[model samples]
Target: MTDTLNAKNHSIEKYLRQDRMPHIWCSGCGIGPAVSCFLRAIDRAEIDPNKIALVSGIGCTGRVAGYVKLDSFHTTHGRAIPFATGLKLAKPELKAVVFSGDGDLVAIGGNHLIHAARRNIDMTVICVNNFNYGMTGGQVGPTSPLEARTTTTPYGNFEPPFNLPYLASASGASYVARWTVLHLRELERAITEAMIKPGFSFIDVIAPCPPIYGRMNKMPLPMDSMHYYQEKTIIRHGADPKEADITLNGPILAGTFVDIERPTFQDQLNHISSKVNAQV
Candidate 1:
């Protein structure tokens, strides 16, 4: 408890394990910013880090579980949500957060994502979509845009990428937001909001993997990636899901895409309990 208190009073750097000084991520990977933003979000929430449980799936982003000095679980690939769902149900007071990758969540774990949203599970999911399977040596992922080159897509990717924010919103996520690593402040705020939200909250962080993924797509440098996001990104408030497709290239079109009050899983269960207890 004292340690958590100290972490709150002092900088998040105090909470980080200096012994784990050099992370395993590549030189220009955006995972570093993602982690930093998450820590900032945690600080902004003013919630005890001890009470937060981080659940992650197998991927580059999944490695976050080991880095954060909290109750963390590095679960199987694409199973972070189900594991988190169980954890939230067992301990409703704890803040359950899922950290996964584009391939980990949208590809293999697509079903889990939607089901969790449908249940309105009280958990926050922050997925880092670098547009390729970076951990696996830059393979084509579900979020990889058309014409993007990958290991598998040597010529050019033909299939359309899933508009993650729109998908999440339509799938019933109570809170949905999208932001690139370049927009660190907004990303931090979105993460904080998602963590505090009572229902399923999903954030698609468009990060850049300069080494493996970006190198293949001609975005080999971190600065180039950042500049790309800066020029292409359009930060808006209260964006409509319907307009997302029409303005894909015009602006990154990121903001609180969807936020609506819904009966959380715990709320429904408690309501049923109250009714039964009344009758008894």
Candidate 2:
């Protein structure tokens, strides 16, 4: 236990800006674990820290860019993808990683998400889904499960949530996966795989919003949310994305749903350019 703690502390000091020592995430919030898993994944993947560029939009998870010790951008609300897209295209050698909350990425930035996947850009997106707009208030969001309660959905959420993995796969993502904060090993593995994958890779990390979303939904303690995730999760690697919809109290379908090789947008562009030059 002591050695593990020491290792994590070392990783935090190495990967994050020490001046930002205390993060602003709430108690029992799962973003911390997600970040830890991410840090470990970067090392395990053998990626050079100097070659990574993390981009995030405005939200709770968006603060990651400001904290990580890497070339990062904290862009305008819902613009993380567009910003990352520009950065990736400009510096194709750098590993572009987009880290943000579901609200920032899928709600207002949904268009960018689909189009980026359609282009099969060489980028990795790590979306922390807490099922509500966590930063402002506990409001229902694009990924709030059906019947999930929140400040806005007092009675219960009527709208169905997007099956994130399914959406990414359908939008042409070259790699897709989902995992809760409770599954640290799996989460880290998925992030590592996504980081090394060549095309548009995405991972939906289901984290707890204990103070707001969880308390409102009856998971009062952070542990309560963690336990819920552990008990409800169903791992089915390579499962069909269409059958992975998440409901308020139903099983949480989690795993890698898609991973297929395809020429990236940059690769295609370079190919065409070479042909044009040859003909000219």
Candidate 3:
């Protein structure tokens, strides 16, 4: 009873900038759950909130920076990764995080995403994938599954959706995982693991955009989307990322695909610096 009342009394109030209350996220939007999980992960991991620097690009998910009670940046569309890269390089001790939507991170910012992973930058990237550009009129986007309908793709999306897990794995992320908003506990744990891990860590959070993408794609109700995720999700740890492509109503692969130790960009830079100093 006490725990329930405490939570009712706004337990999560501390992590949020209350002045920004009444967030813009729509009812039934999965972004709220994803953010809640991230906050819980920080608490569970016992991370010093002050030591974290969050960066977000222009999109629905980008608003996370404004709400989080921490040092954060709301950068231009598709520039979140580069900003985070600079922050990580300048302050290697502080954990850099990039929180953005599919369109902002993997669409115009796709180049930055792959290069950061390739360099193994010490940062965490949380990508909220709602299959379409939820905020911007629900257009078909890079992550829109094949044949999925959107405002732009009224009939169906012919272009093959980017297999995010495979792309991240191939580009060389140190840690990668995918989870639906329905898997609350697993999602929280994954965020915690990603935050604690070194090198470029990426999380693909498959979420629902009920009024727009979901309604257009036949998941008119939020519960419809939730049921679909519950029924279709496949938990396969260490599975090959190549086979984790998400098609319309296909088996959704959810798990950590990559968790390997690799030299981060900072480590390489330091090594070269040390070598140059030895010759000097």
Query: If scored against the real structure, what TM-score would every candidate get?
Result: 0.92, 0.96, 0.96
Q: Which tens-of-lDDT digit does each residue in 179-245 have in candidate 1?
A: 8898899899999989888899999888888898778878889887888888987777788865554
For candidate 2, what is the TM-score? 0.96
Q: Which residue runs of candidate 3 sit more than 4 Å off their true CA positions?
A: 1-10
Which parts of model 2 are misplaced by more than 4 Å?
A: 1-9
User: What is the C-alpha RMSD, rounded to one decimal, of candidate 1?
Assistant: 4.2
Error of 3 at 59 (Å): 0.8
> How many pairs of residues collide in model 1?
0
Cα-based lDDT at residue 53, candidate 2: 94
State residue 239's C-alpha deviation in candidate 2, in Å: 0.3
Error of 1 at 46 (Å): 0.9
Give residue 95's lDDT in candidate 3 (0 to 100): 89
lDDT of 3 by residue, 1-280 (tens): 3343343456566888877878999889999999999988888878999999999999899999999898999999999999999898788889898999999999999999999999999999999999898888999999999899999989999999999989999999999999999999999999999999999999999999999998888889999999999999999999999999999988899999999999999889989999999999
lDDT of each: 0.86, 0.93, 0.93
RMSD of each: 4.2, 1.9, 1.9
